[model samples]
Target: MHTFAPKSIASHWRLIAGLLPWLLTGCASAGYQMPDLSLDSLLGSDQAAARGQPVADIGVTRCDQLTTHEDDWDRVNGVPPVDGEDIDIAAAIPACEKALAEHPGHRRLQAELARAYAEAFRYDEAFRLSGQAAEAGSLYALIQQGHAYRYGRGTPKDIDKAVNAYQSAAKAGHIGAMNYLGSTLYQRDGWGDRSKAESWYRKSANTGNATGMANFAQLLLIDGKQEEAFPWFERAARQGNAFALQQIGTYYAVGGEPAIKAPYTALSYFEKAVEKGRPSASVKAAKLFIQEAGDTSSRLSESERQAKVLYWIEYGMPKLSTRQ
Candidate 1:
């Protein structure tokens, strides 16, 4: 781990979006709570800065042409599969099947076909494809296979099988699996301990996985271990993780004054995150700036950009799960 100054959050300037896609959802209006799992401050303070959107997952942009996305592509993965019975999905299965038949040995094609099957509600076919691909040990195959088992797409509900699949992916150095596995172990009575989570998180982080660092730090920050979490947040922020950037900025904004409602430092953090396009953070930061005398418009725009956040929210809305 390395260290950097917590200097002015006003340092950042470029307005262009980062390389990765953003996922956002507006937190329920004030008193409304998220269903099932506990969520405090759904649309975090940073998200509320401009549009104040809260996100359940990252929005995947069409950088790579995989019609099969991580979201509702597998309805069984708790993403509430897309309401197929449409022309697009109807056409998708045949295309994938054709690709598979020509080359049954093509694991990636097989995986894609499995996604097509799941989307079409052909559970049995999807399971067969996913299982075959996973056993072949393709990274994509393992993740999809794990999702099939974990989400019980075309397969039976088998948490143990899902865990095993995830472990296989992790062993193969799958970033998502590493993050998910760490998180899985973090919420246990005696099995998934925090230390284990941190260890797994570090492994993923060392490989430059931003999600691992951000989620790991988020857990630590919420647990009131700010000092320890600081480095992790910094690592992720440097990777252009807006959420982690906001967390670091918030740490400094709190004044380090020991119990004065440290909004000062938090204001700077909110500004940095807002600049990095955290809608909620930007809006909340604007409110804080006017109340205090900080330079709210340094790196951030005076005019709020609500569309990015709105788009993020709309894109991610379909994937929200009622199940914990």
Candidate 2:
């Protein structure tokens, strides 16, 4: 819902090698197309700026100044649902539409309105404005275009174009774009540029991208640096990545050397992850709860075990299916 300035694109990728792990959370390069679903919970420009590198410095409209169009822009950014609630995505649409009607040449406003459109499931409008913003050098808009192209939401599904879009944005120092570019290049069946992918992930991770941190950590684990990877996973979890939260649960449940196996601790983490909207957490919690209950040395009673198992099977599996 906010706009940032774009960055200058870099021509070549840089690599810093040590060790890497398997990405538990899905990456863009895994041959997975964009889901034909709501992009409601977006990685907004404001959130991205808070997380990592600052984008190009686009000016914010002053609230005190009152050109009707500027006032509309301020309202779109400051008003109820878009400002805090985040649930009612449609609330800002009219304000953005009115502002654009009066100021169609404003590129930042165009990108912001495009994102509002995307959140409202108006892909055709989203794509049009995003393309305009990209042409005007908006890094975030380039990322949006990548999403549109990948999903065939408002355009044909073109993996090459999506990759190009992500790459372009990544070069411009967009953190999400860097993470996505890494994902696409890292996939074995896809472009399969391990070195380039790691470089991209490292750049994002270095800039404090939570997904990048988790992904880079996963690769590190794969390379046998469990000790090194644990801290990155911890960092990502602290940043509220659902995948990292669930992975931490898995870590505790299936403990490695230097980490004591604690099923109860694992269950606690799994429960927290579920509360954070990860379905995998439910499966892990249920599995571990049942395991602990079934273990003869444990103190859980027969009634408690039955109750827990029933709760998970009856409540968790259905939810997991829906997530898939």
lDDT of 1 by residue, 229-290 (tens): 77778777766677887776565555462223455556656656666767666655645555
lDDT of 2 by residue, 1-324 (tens): 111111221221222222232222343433445332112123344433432232233344321112112112122333222221242344567766666676665656677777667767788998998777666555667777888877787799876677677766664455667787788767623445676677778877887667898899888878888877777876777776667777777777787554567677667667666766677678778878867654421676778777766765565665332110
Who wins the lDDT comparison?
A: 2
Candidates' RMSD to native = 15.0, 12.3
For candidate 1, the TM-score is 0.58
Q: How far is candidate 2 from the true structure (C-alpha RMSD, Å)?
A: 12.3
Task: Please report the candidate that would top TM-score against the real structure.
Answer: 2
Off by over 4 Å in 2: 1-92, 119-121, 188-191, 222-225, 294-315, 318-324
How accurate locally, in lDDT, is each candidate?
Answer: 0.54, 0.60
The ten-residue window of minimal lDDT in model 1 covers 13-22
